[model samples]
Target: MTFPVVGMVGGGQLARMTHEAGIPLGIRFKLLSDTPQDSAAQVVNEVVVGDYRDLDTLRAFARGCDVITFDHEHVPTEHLRALEADGIPVRPGPDALVHAQDKGVMRARLDAIGVPCPRHRIVADPADVAAFAAEGDGFPVVLKTVRGGYDGKGVWVVDSVEEAEAPFRAGVPVLAEEKVDFVRELAANVVRSPHGQAVAYPVVESQQVDGVCDTVIAPAPDLDESLALHAEEMALRIAKELDVVGHLAVELFQTRDGRVLVNELAMRPHNSGHWTMDGAVTSQFANHVRAVLDLPLGDPRPRAPWTVMVNVLGGDYPDMYSAYLHCMARDPQLKIHMYGKDVKPGRKVGHVNTYGDHLDDVLERARHAAGYLRGTITE
Candidate 1:
């Protein structure tokens, strides 16, 4: 039997992990990376080092692949459309992917679909930002670049028009949104196939630090049963509506009034769903591969009552390998996943997952292991 080759753009850790997931299914992957040092390029046997922004590079990479997908959404939308025009299958095609690539487009689409989201609009200038603020709760409005922003970059919380000037200086469209007074952040992860089959993972609480994901707790604690179901249903509905034939993570904000509003959308395996590596019956990466290949979806059920995933950020320690003995000895059940990248302060190097019946224990184990790996915790 001839197995299909999946072409993934962007060789970040997401691509690396997704490649790993496909290994078990005898699925081959071809990666397009910015450089040979990129995370996935270092692991994927077949890699083409080139820029995703160039149409020719993309065309060259897609030639022998059965289907194309992504690890990140930064690829130019027009390039993806061109690929689709050439008879290449781009899962989460340009039309559906634009929502993930541009914040303004996403908000507009969500609004048209009657999907609850933060009040938002495109701000032409700092004055328009102030006007947007005045229309809502006033001042402290959130400004984000319409495209090319992630992990808190290109996003700003401005208290006044002067503070909002920087976003407009970039020469990119800016979107102003009412700053939501959310009690906590939640993520609803779902996977869908071209055949319309879908699966939703348990709603997970996502904790962010400095605009980057820091930790994720699966089956968000004390979540009302009905609200959890609503989150799952909403995520599934979004995947179907957008014609996303892969993983879709709906980043949500649980307002103080118990309402959930959509914050962001990720059309790939997301950090919030990383806990599934050891916690779920089917990891998001595996399901993503299956979805893109149009195969039957897998179960998304949790294997344990509580599972916690903590990101391992790079720190002063350059050699994290030295600390593995201590972390492994401390908690034998901890699962560590590290990207083969050099350590740099504040860079995401890897993550740790811990699952058990006790939430507190699970949380502590995951945090400690991640901290130890990052040189934040000793003894």
Candidate 2:
């Protein structure tokens, strides 16, 4: 049978990498982007420039495609539901999409399902922050906007009641949560199919700098077997609970007391899993495509004993291509991925990944190469 064409919403880097995965699977990928200069548009030829929030744009994009999925969760829920209502196939449908769309909705649903999470209170107004602080854990609680928060944006730390009032004064809807005292941050990833088959990847440790991820160590260095198993179990449980028919990324916090608390969720391919592209037996982008296409899930095993990925921030390099050669010359084993984006301060330009039989060797090489790219080292 001939493979079906995949229609993807959003033409960002995730879609660009997904296109790379689709090529090997013999699947056609069509992208819907608002601009011609989007990352995926530069790589994938089949694209329609349109706003994902517009039903007319969506209808046109969905036409002649066998299945619909997303690069990001920014699509209007009503538009997605309308597509389904019109008999279009949208994977990880509106029911599952909502969890990624609105953090408030996700917190409530996960809490109802008895998922482990930090104590939180919804603040329709900034005053509720002080009220929650008084009742719940006080000082240094996190203030986050329930919607449109990502990569440290829309999140703030309130040391006192006065600090919580800043967002309200700015007209932002915020939610207060007890600031988690965690030992480390971990990410569990899994992909589920429409057939109910699912596979989980090894949980990895993520290192964040000022709310942006800078590095990732796969299999999470010094991870206890029990904790690793627990993380995978938590990921599997969430995928099943949400009935998600695509890749799901569960961000977790390992508390000081050895308990893992749910931090956040991503229903699409996540930055934390980018190491899998050059490290795992099957990349998340490829698995997501297979899941949404209703194909059998691929192996989630690691190809090597260890894999480490370091993100390259845009501002660190004067010329990305020049830095690329310098890094590659030093460590040829390092695999570098450069997104076709203009260099800008604090933007994620690309990543470098290293894999090997020895975990230390992989990490050492990855770090050195990454540091070189960032101009932290001469060699």
Candidate 3:
């Protein structure tokens, strides 16, 4: 009996972890990577070094795979459509993925569906950005390039039109939105199979540091139960409406006024769901694979009362072996997952997950381990 082949485009840590998840099930992975050194390419045995942007390269890569998936949203939508036209199943097909690829499209579609979102509009110029601001709360408006931005690279919170000019300079369509007055950020993660079976993980509170995710707390301490249910239902509805057949992460803003507004949508495994690696009955990567394969969904229940995941950002220290020893010896319960990437300042090299009954202790343990690994905490 031969296992099915899953073609994963892009070679980031997401693909790396997803490949690991498939190991137990004997699922074969074919990876298309930019370089042999890419995170996933280092581990996936069948690596094809090619440019995902090149149609010929993509066509060659998909020839033998049973189905195609992605480590990121950057793949050209037309290319995905082309693959589907060739009878290759692309999980989270182009129609649904285009929304995540383009901010303007996502905002427009979400609005049409009556989803709660911050006031926004596509702005053509700095003057238009100012006008958009005036239409809302004014100044300190948020500007984002409609495509190709990630990890806070294509976003700006500008106090004036002068500050908004940079986004338009990229020559991409720019989306202007009101700066949400949110108390904190939240994430609702759900997995959907092609046949419509779906499961929602507990809502999680995600903390960002300079636009990059730093930490995630499962069950979002003190979150209203009704609102959590609403967020979960909303995510499930979105998956069905958009025809998404894999993991969908709804990045949200829980406003100070007790409202939750949609901030962003990720159509694959996301940083916010990282805690599921150790804290949940099934990891997001494993379930994502199951979903794309149209297999039974897994239980999304948490194993512990509180689970905290802290990202280990690269710092001054390039060699983390010593730090790893210190952290592991100190907290044997800690789970450390590292990507095989060379450390560079501010880059996400790995993460640490800590779970327990007490939220504070869980948070501290995760933070301390991550900090120690990054050389931010000596003791």
All candidates' TM-scores?
A: 0.99, 0.97, 0.99
Write down the lDDT of every candidate, Cα atoms only.
Answer: 0.94, 0.88, 0.94
Prediction 3 TM-score vs. true: 0.99
What RMSD, rounded to one decimal, does every model reach?
A: 0.8, 1.4, 0.8
1 or 2, which is superior by TM-score? Answer: 1
What is candidate 1's lDDT per residue for 177-248, written digit by digit as tens? 999999999999999999999999999999999999999999999999999999999999899888988999
lDDT tens digits, residue span 304-355, model 3: 9999999999999999878878898899999999999999999999999999
- Candidate 1: list runs displaced more than 4 Å: none
| TM-score result, candidate 2 | 0.97
Please give the TM-score that candidate 1 achieves against the real structure: 0.99
Is candidate 2 or 3 superior in TM-score? 3
lDDT of 2 by residue, 200-298 (tens): 999999999989998898889888999999989988988889888899999999999998889999999999999999999999999999999999988
User: For model 3, how many clashes?
Assistant: 0
